[model samples]
Target chain A: MAEDALRILVIDDNRIRASVIEQGLLEAGYSHVTVITDIEALMRCVVEIDPDMIFIDLGNPNRDSLEAAFAVSKAARRPIAMFVDRSDAAAMSAAIDAGVSAYIVDGLRKERVKPILDLAIARFNAFFRLQRELEETRSALAERKIIEKAKGILMQSKGISEQEAYDLLRKQAMRQNRKLAEIAEGLVLAAGLLE
Target chain B: MTGLRHQTQIALGFVPLLDASPLIVAQAKGFALKEGLDLRLLREMSWAALRDRISIGHIDAAHMPAPLPIATTLGLGSLPVELETPIGLATGGNAITVSEELWRHMRDAGAPEVAGDPIACGQALKRVLEACQKQPARPLVFGVVHPFSSHNYELRHWLSAGSIEPDRDVQITILPPPFMVDALEAGRIDGYCVGEPWNSLARKHGSGRIVTTKNRLWPGIIEKVLAMRSGAVDADVTRRLITAITRAAEWCDDVNHREELADLLSQQDYMALPPPCLMPGLTGELMLGDAPPSLEPDFLRFGGSATVPLPSQALWLYAQMLRWQQTSFSPQDAERAAAVYRPNLWCEATGLALPQPFSITTFDDVHFDPGQIQTWLAQYAACVE
Candidate 1:
């Protein structure tokens, strides 16, 4: 938990993600952080560096790394910032949600693990939130485009005003207990049939 | 035609291993259609994903490792889920492959030439490894498909036979079979034990040489089994699926249908390997790097007694689970897991005569009885524990 010279090993396949993690750790005032890309070199690095904490990006979730952690955890049983009691379902769920798969060697200080796990969970949550927002925006844009296309088709086929076409879709949505986006999607799909 | 009845469509998941033959056969040979089932085979990347998908109800059933259902039921790797069994699809199709560099090392170290003989090759490699260990930092890196895999247990068995301590003398790593050849070629691993057509592909690509076949090491071993969620057994659709799979397995075991079987497996729907590349392995042939491939028909066994789920194989797998420190399931747990092997259900589905007397104490060529299996497992533990 010391601010000065806390050793951290950051593993990520993506160079940008690794740099971001390394920068984040550095910015958080941790020193002596190492970023590694090759999963095969993990065991050797674990032996040589003996980092206080290991941070693995969840994007890849390589089986080799997980197996290595299991073997190393069993072999050394060292106290590091990764082990949590299997009985602690809450901690386990939080750890899994954080995109960090970890094993702590026995005898490691609990405080050492908490900070790294806290940081990891925060980063994972941030990434997930950003992803959700991006998806929502993309879906909304797609829905708007579809509704515009449906309005154009209605104007050409049935000679209805844009306002009338919008009212029809809204009426259908209310009648079917579906969202306006769903109604618009159906309209766009139906419009494609004329071609 | 008889009065039309409602047909249930299902999506079954499987990894692209040779042992998944029954599922492939059922779908490919129209057995599923005959049974009023519309079964689609979904190829998955990893066993972990397969288990997760099945547990989440994304897949109706799966052709999984025999130990998987029991392991999941016991919550060894993940959450507990009730698993049911109607039939075991195929048995005993795994082998160990050593990199060309490791093969050369063994050759230079007075290892006897076996040509295509796996046992002899294994013995020779053991001698070379023993001599090589006198030098410091000479750790041999080996790979297995999964920690809970039969390939891992078989590899340990082969290594123990040569008096090699798997953990102390060698580094045993878990690598997916699809990546085994690439890892070997890149010298990331010195050797691997995996299921076919991986071994065959390794040999063909000249990445590695076959050290031993599981059939040679332990004949008639159970490889993959057909498994369903525990609640699935109550469904009429699941019953139909079991019958369809049993019929396909019988057809697959027919020697005359070997070509057709190869064609089915080679299709994009299953293993997706070329017919010629996969045919020899499916037919039980040894595709060696140095010499001509040898025929060993019992290599990829299916149906008959081999397909009958044996309690003894379950016991063997349980012993392996204990040995690997994956679980500490007691004798009661072993018995309960073994009971999940439904031989009678297989009989009902296939309409084949059940093996008379149902020996539970005999160590047949293909399966060891529960008692013999316990003894064998205990002996292995004594040697390696």
Candidate 2:
């Protein structure tokens, strides 16, 4: 914990995530921290700053950050915690699950890598949890909108009460083994065509 | 009728490159429909995702670099999956483009007027880089689409040939194709090697100029292929999928349908670029210069020589993988993987007349042969090991 304040670079296309990671690293007592929103700027910063570790917040399924790590790893060979031995299956899996993409050069001591890696994993997992929750909320709201439109269609088409329409769609979804949202979407499409 | 009654739908992954024409053609032209398939093309952002999805069976097939199947078979991407390429998509569409500043520097360095020659351009560009490296500024940043791509290997080969060490002299980074022109314009990367129409698009955007095409680097090299999981190909569904792809490939080869093809690719669901941006690669008429830009067709090609899945091309790709230490497998692995280049399947699907001799050597201009291959691999393995 005492081999010079761990220099960290937190990169995220999202400004909020970058700020949160930057703040989190600062609160964790790592004084040297830099945050970058542009992916293009990251390579230069990495070479100049030579941070002890890098934490990238990549929400998209693309492997942009991972690809960058390969280049950085090959160029600088920095002893960052990210490029831990691929033979260490447990650490490798944990690192991937934690959403931390990493590369390590030769400068840093081997023993120092584990603790830094552990911290990065924790931070990434926390961010991912928050993101998943946000997505769930949005999807739920969209599904609600679809269900409402489908209920309105049923009310107009069959002259059914609101409660009765809901029951009808629910019964149809269960019978077809389809999600209520899917059945609702179909109902809405059919109604639009008919009208 | 029996096969159609139990038709299987398969999901395929693709990165939006000009070489992905086969998969797109199959989907758009009802080739898959004719064969009783519901083939879905899932556009991915990078080769890494496509490799991962195919490895995990999330995608039944993928449009991948010629090197990918062999690389994966050798467990280069951390997972081993048996893959086969029944149809070659397109070839000779990649090019190297450098920023305006770098281009100007090279022009002053007695860079020859070789027009489309990448090797000459690379040699000239290297001198510019050497002079610029005197100052302790950051290394020149170059971009490539993916690690296992032919563009990546070609860039490395061209750089090394110019006496420039890839990782040492310049920093090569991976930028998605869509972002390459913009990144170059912003001065983030000095140069990039990627497939069209991004190379052509960069010229149009006034961000950079095409230094040389891959056709100049290695003419008629197999660039991309339609890959399917070994398991997926065994199922009845593959016949229909291959049929759809074969028809699409023929449709693409028709010069009269060039505009229609461009229109299809320009949809938001596909390349998402303007039809004009996608036209150059398809029509073989790319504008590489500014003001009065000169037209350079052959920037992209589909069908004809592009469709032949030659074992020699597979061998060349294997050599690249070996050179990069991307795979641990030996030269024997290359021979084994080349077996997956199923020209017979292509004949069946296309109903094209076959040559009397089924096998053809892929070495066009390259000097290396299978015997030389063994010796080269042995020496390479010795150094790396």
Candidate 3:
């Protein structure tokens, strides 16, 4: 069978991560790709799609149900093997570390599935990196707001300029050997408690 | 003192359930710390994921179901890995819970009101299944945690004892423990056999009723084991883990620590359930439906003799695999399966006495002799064949 003719199914609860992999599969010219976000009807969906390969996020709890489904499918003579290339320990570990697992129908050549597995691992890693960066950016913005609030509180209470208030926070942080955010957060919490 | 100088960092994986208390308490209550081990407990969403994580060396060890190591060793489902069970985590926290509607149907079929009677309940279910086959014609569906789980084997044993053939009379599917209550509510599954907080939560939600427990089916049955790669972990580290977890298990089993254990387990990083949800399994004072709290002292046991990894129990689990057609009979494979549970390692680690072989007793009074498994398994030919 042609590689493009292989029907691929992706199951991920995270909608964004699912789309990232879905977009990658489609852009790579895999035409018969189906992404399933709702796993309530997972068994039925798997039967209906009859995908040649299944890419599932390792974090999904429904992965157990999928395992059971594959067991049933194996009984029906269409065995599905969890993607484990014992020879390529590095790739196997990389996929596991990236939280990506795949199941392929038996008789699919190794060379045929390797590219898809690589794509999934790459996509999943990219999505995870994107999520981490977004979280860091949000926390940084929140820290800036807290620091500003602490500066305002110091400027109002001590009758000092904004620069002096900033210096006070920096000095307190340095003296305590803590982060500036910690000092700002302590002041904000203390101010709220006092009120 | 020199051993305490270098702390071993171990990443232990587990599913969030009541039975994971030992691993949690080992870290939480300073037991692991006392052994100079920094235990990091990572909760996996599925057993498959946990097994994969451990396979690729992502995690050092896991709180695993008893039969999982055997199945993995036998290469039943996934790739064969040399997983070893140095210590049994806990025994008998699993319960078979049925939907409230199904419970009503079961009661109408002359099932007893009280719990802990597997034979009576199985007969009642057989009658109910006979009735269901008449009009609705749909087989009752039950969910288990994994294919290679005590929940699956025990549930199959219960159904087959009732003359109700599993997969034919009733469909046994796998559902994560967390999804069981919702599945019961949604009527996606008629019943499930899962570990605690799930069974208790289902009963509390008014969606399911407890029928029989692991202790009821097979008292002192091994449920979860501490599984790790056979030669991957250092022997000293493994021994220290055994000691720490054994101490934690004893603490968890004590009546005085029940409330505290529940509180610790209810924290966000562990089971994260209400303390009340965990109390029943810990105390064994289960509130099955509207009946008064049934006090089955042996409902769930930790530490003590429960910590011993019995090779006979491994054979019994391998027998279930054979009985259920999960794997075929092979003397070499059976040896491999039994070798998965290392009582000698347990003894060397904790200086604990290993339980006698072929000592496993069940509710049905079937004597399983590890010496004569072929002869003993002949009785089940009527079901297995």
iRMSD in angstroms, per model? 6.4, 5.8, 1.7
Better of 1 and 3 by DockQ: 3
Q: Rank the candidates by DockQ, best first.
A: 3, 2, 1
Which candidate's lDDT is highest?
A: 3
Instruction: Give the per-residue lDDT digits (tens) of candidate 1, residues B1-385.
Output: 4512655688888888777878888887788988888888878656754654565565788888788777767756555676766677877788888988888877775544554455466567778776776875558899887776788888876776667778777888878777889988988789988888888888888888886677776666677887777775355676688788877888887889878877877878667777887777778778664657887657878777667776666776776787667777576778777766666666666677665433432111233455665565566567655
Model 2 per-residue lDDT tens digits across residues B1-385: 5667855677888887767777788878877767778778888776665654565456788888887776666655444567788777787888888888888888887565444565567678788887887866778889987677788888887787666778678988777788888889888899999888888787877778887777667766778887876756563466557677766877887889888988888888788878888877877675553324455555566666677666666776777776776665565687776766666666665677543322223212334454356655554345331
TM-score of each: 0.69, 0.69, 0.93
Q: In candidate 1 chain B, where is summed lDDT lowest over 10 consecutive residues? A: B357-366
Collision pairs in model 3: none
Give the i-RMS of model 1 in Å: 6.4
**Could you give candidate 1's per-residue lDDT for residues A2-120 as a string of tens digits?**
65466777777767557766776777778788988887787777777776666765334354335435544545534232322322445545655555544444455666666666776
In the order shown, the candidates' Cα RMSDs to the true structure are: 8.3, 8.1, 2.5
Question: Considering DockQ, which of the candidate structures 1 and 2 is the better prediction for this target?
Answer: 2
True contacts kept of each: 0.04, 0.20, 0.75
Model 3 lDDT at residue B317? 91
lDDT of each: 0.71, 0.71, 0.87
